[model samples]
Target: MFAALAWSLHAADAELRRALVPTSRYTPSELREGLCAALLARSSARRRRVVLEVTLIAGVNDELQHAHQLADFIAPIERACFDPRRKSGRTGVLINLIPYNPTYNRLAEGETVESRNDMSTLGIPHYSFFERPSWERIDAFQDALRARGVWVSVRASRGDADASACGQLATNRKLAAT
Candidate 1:
C-alpha cells in the first residue's frame, strides 16, 4: 500500500529499481550468504548492475552487530567508516546500502540517524539514520547518500497497518489452555 502510494506520488521522478525483503529474522550470515548467492547467480550482477541488500525491519544494533561483522566476509569496500564501533576497512563497491527502520511508534515525528557510512562501500546502503526516523531527517540522509554518489530511499510497508512494530512483532503462539 505504501509502496503503491509512494509510486503514485513519485513514480515519474523515481528510480527505485530493486527491493530488499524487510526482516531481521535471518541472522546476518544467513542474509549475507543468501544475498551473495543470489548476486552470484544473477547475470546482471555479473554485469555489475543489480545490488543485493539487507532490507527494512532487518539490521544489527550495537549488541547484535551481525551487519557489522558480516562486512569481513564480503569483499573490500572503497572508503571504510571511521567509527570504531562499526565494522572497519572497506573502500568501494558498484552499489551501496540504504536500509530502513521499522520499529516506529507514533512518537516518530522528526528525527534522524547519522552513520559513519564506510559500510556503504559494500553496495548495501545503511540508512544513515536508525530507529523510527522522521520525514524531516530523511532529506539529510538523502543528501548524505547523494554525497556518496549513491541513490537513497526509505523502504515502505505494503500490508497490514497493525503488522506489529518491526522488531516489535512478537507474539506467543501457544496460549495456556483454559
Candidate 2:
C-alpha cells in the first residue's frame, strides 16, 4: 500500500491492479494497457492516474518484444498515443533504460545506440540515464538525444555521499568496518 503512494500514476479502475513499482516492464502498448486494465479491475483506487514503470528498451525482454505490436497491445488504453500529443493526464510512462545498469558495460553503449535507437524506431517517448558516459561528450549526449525530448539523466558522483548514487555502495562498507 505504501509503495503505491510513491508512484504518481495510479489507476482507480477496480479491475485494473497496477500499483506503482520501482522496477519497469516493457511490452507492446496493448499488452501494457491490458496488464494495467487487468490490475485496475481488481484493485481499489480513488486516483486513476498512476505512473506505470515501464521499460522501453532496458533488459533482455525489452529486446525481444516486437515494435509493430504496440497499437494492438495497448488497446485497453483506448486512446493512448504512442507519441502523446499532450501531457494533460496524470498517467505517464517512466521509461527505464535497458541492459539494466550501463556502468561496467565494456560492450557497446546499449542505452545510446541500441535502446534509444529502438525507442525511436517504435516512436515511443523515453528517458535514459547513463552510467558513465564521458563527461566531455555530454554536449553530444544533449544534442543527439535531449533535443528530441528523450531526456538523458547522467549519474553524478559529487563525492563520497554521491558515491552511493553512482552504485558504489561498497564505499560505505570500508568506513563502517573501520
Candidate 3:
C-alpha cells in the first residue's frame, strides 16, 4: 500500500491545498496527523511497506527549502515505521519523487478558459500555473533528500507521450472521446 502525499504539508500553504484539492475534506494538519496515526498502527510486526509519492511541480513546491521541509516532516514518521528487529533494517518508508506531467484542460470545445472557476479567489493560482521542474532541479531535489538520509527515488517519465503516464489516465479517456 502507498500514500501519495503530493506535497509537503510543512512547505505548502494550507489554502493552496484546499484550492487544488477542493473535494478533500481534511485539512493539511489533519491529514498529516492521520497519516502518522496510520503508520504507527501498522508499525508492529508484519508491518506493511508504504511508499510516499510527492509530485514535484516547478515553482510550486520544488525548491531546496521544500526538500528540507519534506525531510523534517518525514523524520518522525520514518522513525515510527523503522523496525530494528527486522533483519533488513529497513524503515518500511520510501519516498518517490515524481516529475509533474502536464495535462490538457478538461474544457469542452468552445468553452472559454476564463469561464472556469477562478482559483485566484482562494488566494492561489490555478493548477495550470505550475509546470514540471527541469531535470537539473529534480536531481538537486533528490540530492537534498539523500543528504538528509531519506530513501528517495525519482520516478522515470514514461508513457506521457501516449497519455498513459501518472496523472494522465483521465486525460487519456478524454482524448479518446474527442
Candidate 4:
C-alpha cells in the first residue's frame, strides 16, 4: 500500500483552502511544514510511493507565484524521497495537480451567498469562484513544476458527464446556466 497525503496546498489561496477543508486549523505554512515532515517519514519506509496531491484552481492556486511556492515547499521532500544514499532510496515523489472540481451554485435558498460569506471570514478577498483554467495556464504551471525537477502531472478529468471528475459538478451547473 502506498502512503500519501492528498493535501490541497493552495499556497497563496489560504482562504480557499480553509473554505474547502474546514477540519484543519493549520495555516498554509503549517500545512506545508507538516506535509514535508510526513513525506520524509513516509519515504523512510522505503516500500511506498510518496504522492502529494495539490488541487489547482484557475484564478486561485494556478498562478505563477503559487507554483514557485509549491516548488520551494516540495523541493526538500522530493529530495528526501528520491535520495540516492540509502539501500531503499530513490523511492520517487509524484506531485499530482488536480484542477478544482467546481461546485454548483445552490442559490435557490441563499445558500450560495452564505457559503461565500463563510469563505470571506478568513480575511482574504473571498474568491474561490473560478472557471476551468486555460490550456496555456495549465501548461505554464506544469512547466514551472518540471523546471524545479519535480515529477508532476495534470490529472485528467474523469466522469464529467456524471460529474465524477474534478470541477464537473460546477461545470454541469454552469452549462445549465449558459
Best by TM-score: 3
Q: If the candidates were sorted by their lDDT against the true structure, best first, what order would they fall in?
A: 3, 4, 1, 2
Candidate 4 lDDT over 1-178, as tens digits, reads 5555455555635555666566768787676666667656663545435667777767667888878887777666665566565463334667788766655444555456455555545533334455567878988998998887777888887875566676454433324445
List runs of model 2 lying over 4 Å from the truth. 1-34, 42-46, 52-130, 133-161, 166-168, 172-178
lDDT of every predicted structure (CA atoms): 0.33, 0.31, 0.70, 0.65
- For each candidate, how many residue pairs have backbone atoms clashing (under 3 Å)? 17, 24, 0, 2
Local accuracy of candidate 3 as per-residue lDDT tens digits, 17-92: 6666677688866776777687677636337455667888777678898788778777767776677776866676
Q: What C-alpha lDDT, on a 0 to 100 scale, does residue 154 get in candidate 1?
A: 53
Off by over 4 Å in 3: 1-13, 43-48, 86-89, 106-114, 121-125, 170-178
lDDT of 2: 0.31
Best by lDDT: 3
Distance (Å) between predicted and true CA of 166, model 2?
Answer: 7.2
Better of 2 and 4 by TM-score: 4
Worst 10 residues of 2 by lDDT: 13-22
- Higher-lDDT candidate among 1 and 3? 3
Q: In candidate 1, which residue ranges exceed 4 Å CA deviation?
A: 1-47, 52-131, 164-178
